[model samples]
Target: MDPTFLSAVQLAALVRGGKIGALELLDHFIGRAERLDSRINAIVVRDFDRARQRARALDNQADKSAPLFGVPATVKESFDVAGLPTTRGHAALKDATVRVSTLPVRRLEAAGAVIFGKTNVPVDLADWQSYNPVYGVTSNPWSTAHTPGGSSGGSAAALAAGLTGFEMGTDIGGSIRVPAHFCGVFGHKPSWGLLPNYGDPATSSAAGTDIACLGPMSRSAADLQAGLEILAGPDPDETALTLNLPAPRATALKGLRAAVWADQAGIAADPETTAAMLALADALEREGAIVSRSARPALDPLDAYHLYLKLLDAAWSGRLTEETLASRRRDLARLKDSDQSADAVMLRMTDVPHRLWLGLNEQRFRLRRAWTAFFREWDVLLCPAFATAALPHRQDGNTWERRITVGGREIAYNDLLFWPGLTGGYHLPATVAPIAATQAGLPLGVQIAGPIHGDRTTIGAAALIEQALGGFKPPPGW
Candidate 1:
C-alpha cells in the first residue's frame, strides 16, 4: 500500500499489525520528503539519523498500543526539539540550539512518534507567508506560486504534499487554522491552557497570555483527535492539576445544532468562500442537523474585533524593545480618538498600564462568558477560515503595507485575523476542515468553533463534516 497518503492512525495500525515495519515506515517518509521537499520547502530541518535510530528502537519493542506508535511526524520550527534550532525563522537566532525538548515534543515522542524534522515559519511568525533569511519561502503544494499560509505554513504544506503523517503547531493569530485552510488539511486550536507551553521560548515565561495555544495539525480529523489525546494534560511542574475534557456532545450528525456565520458586516469574505460555507450548512440541514444562519452571541462584531486586537497586541507587547515601545507611544499620542484602524489599535494597546490591561482582561473574560452562553444553544459555529483561498506568494518586504484583494476590494493584510480571532481571542476551541475548492481549484475551508474546553466537540463536528464531504485530497502530481 502507498504510505504517503495514509493517515497517522492508519500508519500506526499497520505498524502494530506488522503489516509494515516501523523503521521501514520512517524510511518511506524520509525518502519521500527528500525527493519532494525541495519543491515545497516544508521540512527545512531534517533529523533523519535520529529518526532512524528511534524507529529501530521502536521496532524492537513488544508493546505497540500507543496511539501514535511508530508514526513519523514533523513539528513547526518554533517548537524546541533538543539539539535543533528554534529560530522561529529569525536569521540571527538561526544558529541558536535548544538543549531541552518542548513539552509537546516530549509528549509526542512518549506516544511513540518519531519526529524527524521541523517545518518552516515566517520571520518571528508575524506574517501570513512563510519566508525567512534562514529558510526560503514555503510554497503551496497545490500551486507553487501561492503560499501555504504562514507561521504554521510549512506544517500544512508538508501535510498537503504527503511529506509527513502529522504535525503540531502553535496558534496565536490563526497560525494553525489559516495554514490548514489554505493547504486543505486539518488543524485544531485547543482551549486556552489545554496544552502545556513549557520550553517554548516565545511563551515560556508568559503566564497570563491565554490567547496563544498549541495544538495538532494533520491531514485527517481522526489524526487530530489522536494527536490531541497524546498532548493534552497539565504541565509537569503543575503536578497537582489534572485535566478531564468531556467527550463530544454527540457522535453523529443527526439532531446537531449548528450556527453559520459566513460574512460579518465589516469583514467581506470572497463569494466563493461564502458559497462554500453556506453549502456546508445546507448539507448539514439535509442531514437532519438544525442549522441557523442568523444566530449570534449578542456581542457586536466590531466591538469583539476591537477587543481581540487590543488583547492580542497586549499579549505580544512583551517582545517589543524599549526603543520600539517609545516609538509606539509617540505614535499613540498622535492618534485621534476616531482612529480605529488595526495599526492604531495596536499602537494604543501596546505597553498599556497594568490597570488598563486589567480592564481589557476583564472585558475579555466577559466576551468569553458571552461565547460560553451562546454555545449552550449551538453545537458548533461554522464560518469561513479566511476571506479567500490560498493566495499567490506576496513577499514584497513591508507586511504592514501589504494588501490582499478580497472580492475585488483591497484590504489590510492583517484583516485575515478577524475570523480566527473571534474564537482565539475568547479562548474557544476551533477546528479547520476543508470543505470545497475555488474556481481556480485552490482549497477553501470552514472553521468549527466551540465553547471553552470544547476541543472534542469542535473536532467531532469537523470529523463529521470531513466524512460527509471527503477530506485531505492530495495535490496533483504530489
Candidate 2:
C-alpha cells in the first residue's frame, strides 16, 4: 500500500507487522524529502546518515513493539537534536552545536522513532510566518503563496505535504494549533506541567515555562494521543515524581456536552470562520451530542486576553535581544498610564516587576478556577483557532507593527492573539481539528478546549468529530 498520507499509528503498525523493514521505512521518507521537499521547504536540516544507522539497529532488535517503532519523524528546528544546530532560525547561532539531545528528543529516540531531520521556524519563533536568514520561507502545501502557520509552520507544512511520518512542535502562542488549523491537520496542546520542556533555545532550566509546552501535530487525533503517551511524563531530573493522565472521558459522542463560542465581543472573527464553527456545532447536535451556544465561562474575554498578554510578555521576556528590550522599555516610558491597547500592555509588561507579577499570578489562579467550574458543566468548548484561514507570506517589518484585514476590518496583527491566548493563558488543554474550508479553499480549524487536565475529553471530542464529519484531507494536487 502507498503510505503517502497514512497516519503515524498506521505506519508503526506496518513496521510491527513486518510489512516494511525499519531502515526501508526511514529511506522511504528520506527519498520523498529529497525529491519533493523543494516546493514546501519544510525539512531544513537533514541527518540522513545517522537516522539510517539507527533504523538499521532497530530492524535487528528481537522485540519490535515500541509505541513508535520505526516511525520516521522530524521535530521543530528549535528543539535540540545532539549534533544538529539549535538555531531557532537565527544565522548567528547556526554554528553552535548542541552537546546533548533535549529531553523530548531523547525520549522519542528511546521510544523507537528515527528522527531523520529538523524542520524550519521563524526567527526566535516570534512570528506566524516561518522565514529567517538561516532558512528560507516555508510555504503551505495547499497554496505556495500562503504560510503554513508558524513557529511550527514547517512542521504543519511537512505533514500536509506528506513528507514525514510524525512531528512534534512547541507552542507558546498558537505555534502548534495555528499551523495545524492552516494546514488542515490535527494538534494537541497538553495541560501545563503535563510534559517536560527542557530543550529550549537559551536556557536549560528544569522548571517549565509559564505558557509554553511541547506537544504533537499530526494527520490524526489518534496520532496525537499516541504521541502524548510517548512524550508526556515527569522531568527525568525529578526522579521521585510520576505522571498518570486519565483516559478519555467519552467513549462515544452520544452524551457529550459541547459548548460553542464562535465569536467573542472584543475579538472580530471572519464571518466565514464563525459560520464554519456554528456549522460544526450543528453537526454535533445531529450526532446525539449535547450542544450549547449560549453557555459562557462568565469571565470577560478582553480582561482575560489582556492578562494573558502580560504573562506572555514576562514568560518570553528573557528571549528578546537586548536592543529589542531596550526599545520596548523606552517606548514604555512614553506611554500614558491610561493606555491599555494590546501593544501598550505588551510593552509595559516586558520588564514587569516581580511584585506586580505576584498580583497577576493571583488573578490568574482565580480565572483558572472559573474555567474549572465552567468545564464541570460542559465537556469541551469549541471556538475558532484563529480569526481566519492561513494568510499569505508576511515577511515585512516587525510583526507587532504589521496590520492585516480580517472580516473586512483592519486590525493590528498581534491583536489576533485573543483566540489563542484566551484558553492558553489559564493553562487549559486544547486540541485543533479540521472541520471546514473557506470558499477560497483555505482550511478552517475549530479549537476544542477543555478544563485543565481535561486533555482526554477534548481529544475524545475531536475523535468524535472526525468519525462523524471527516478528518485531515490532503491539499489539492498532492
Candidate 3:
C-alpha cells in the first residue's frame, strides 16, 4: 500500500513498530504538499518547521504507544493554533495571532499526532465552496474544475488527495459532511457539544457556540472513528465532568434498521445524488439490513427548515457586523408575510428578540422529541448529503444570491440546506461515507444520521458501508 493512502491508525502503527520513523512520515507528507499543493491548494497555512520538530521529538521518544503515535495531520484554519493566524480567510484577520491551541488541537497533540498546517476555509466560514480572499481557493482532487466543499473544503481535499494522514473540522450546516461527500471521504458531524471547541474564530471565549460541532474528517471510516475518539471530549475547564458517549449498536449490516430519504417531493435533489443513496440502500437490504424508503420523522420538512434557518442564524447572530445586520434588516423589509424562502427566513432571524427566541426554542424542542421518537425505530437514516456533488467553482457572490440547477430546474443555492439543516439543526449526529460515483465519475456519499449522541451508531454504520462499497477510491491522477 502507498504510505500516502494509509490511514492515520496504520501510520501510527508503522511508526510504533519501527517500520517508519515519525519524522520521515511527516516529511513524506510535507514533501507532497510542497510539490503538489499548488493544484489543490488545501494546506493554506504552513507550519511545517514546527511540525518537523514535533515529529523528530516523537521519533526520539522511547514510548510510542499513544493512540495517534507519530501520525501527521492538519485542522481547519478557523481552529486556534498558538502563534498561527486563525484567519477564516478574511484579510483583516491576516495578522491576528492565535494565543492558544483549540481543545481539538490540544487533544490531537496529546494523542501523539503531529499537527502540520491548517486547511483553508471561506470568509466567516459561511459558504460551501472553499474560496476566500486569504487562501484563494481549494479545488477538489476529483475534479479541479469543481470545489472540494466548504467551510471544511480544504480539510476534505487534503485527506482525499493523500496530503495529510488525518484532519479535524467543524460542521454547523454541511461543512464537514458536504466536503466528505464531494471528496469521497468519511466525515463525522458529531452531536452538538460532544466536542469542545475553545479556539474557533467565532467562539474564542471559553464557551462554545450552538448548532455547531467540532469533529473528524478522513479518507477512511476507521480513521474517522479514531479521530473522533481523539477530538471528542470535555473542555479543559470541564474536567470535573466525565465523558461517556454510547458505543456502536451494530457493526454489520445484518439486522440493522436503516431508513432512507434520498429524494423528497418538491425538493430538487439531483437524481445522481439520490441514486447513490438508493444504491447504498439496496446493498444494505441485500446484506439483511432492514431498509425503508418511507420512514420519516413526524415533523414537516419545510417547518424544520424554516426553524433551522432561524436557529442557525441565531447561533451566529452575535458575530454579525452592523453592516451585515443592516443588510438583513433591509432584506427583511422587502419580504412579504407569506415569504418563507430560506433566504427570507434567515434574514428575518437577525437579532431575534429574547422572547421570540424562547418561542423558537420551544418549537425546536418539540421537533427534537419527534426526531427522537423516529430514531427509536431506526438505527440510522441515510439521506443525500447535498443536492449535488462538488459544485463548479462558485465564488461570484454571497450564497443566497447564487443559484443551482437540479433536475433541469434552477433553485436557490441555499435551498439545498434541507438535508443538513433538517438533522443538524436538532443536533443529530451524522456520518458521511462514500458509496459510489456518478456517471461523470464524481464521487457520491450518503449521510448516515442517528439520534442525538448516537455518534457511534452513525460512524459504525459508515464503517460497514465502507466495507460493503469499497470505500474511498483515490481520484484519478492524485
The TM-score-based order of candidates, best leading, equals 3, 2, 1
Cα RMSD of all models vs. native, in order, equals: 1.5, 1.4, 1.4
Local accuracy by lDDT, each model: 0.89, 0.89, 0.89
Tens digit per residue, CA lDDT, model 3, 1-478: 4699888989999999999999999999999999999999999999999999999999999999998999999999999999889878889888878777887888999999999999999988898899998889899999999999999999999999999999999998899999999999989999888888886544386666789988999878898888888877777676867678888889789999999998988788788888878888888999999999999999888888889989998988878889988988888888898866688788888767899999998999999999999989999999999888889899878899997898787888888788899899999999999988888889999999999989999999999988888998988997
Query: Whole-model lDDT, candidate 2?
Result: 0.89
| Steric collisions counted per model | 0, 0, 0
Candidate 2 runs further than 4 Å off: 200-203, 336-339
- Residue-level lDDT tens digits of model 1 in 145-233: 99999889999999999999889998989999999999999999999888987885543553635588999999899999998899998
Against the true structure, candidate 3 reaches a TM-score of: 0.98
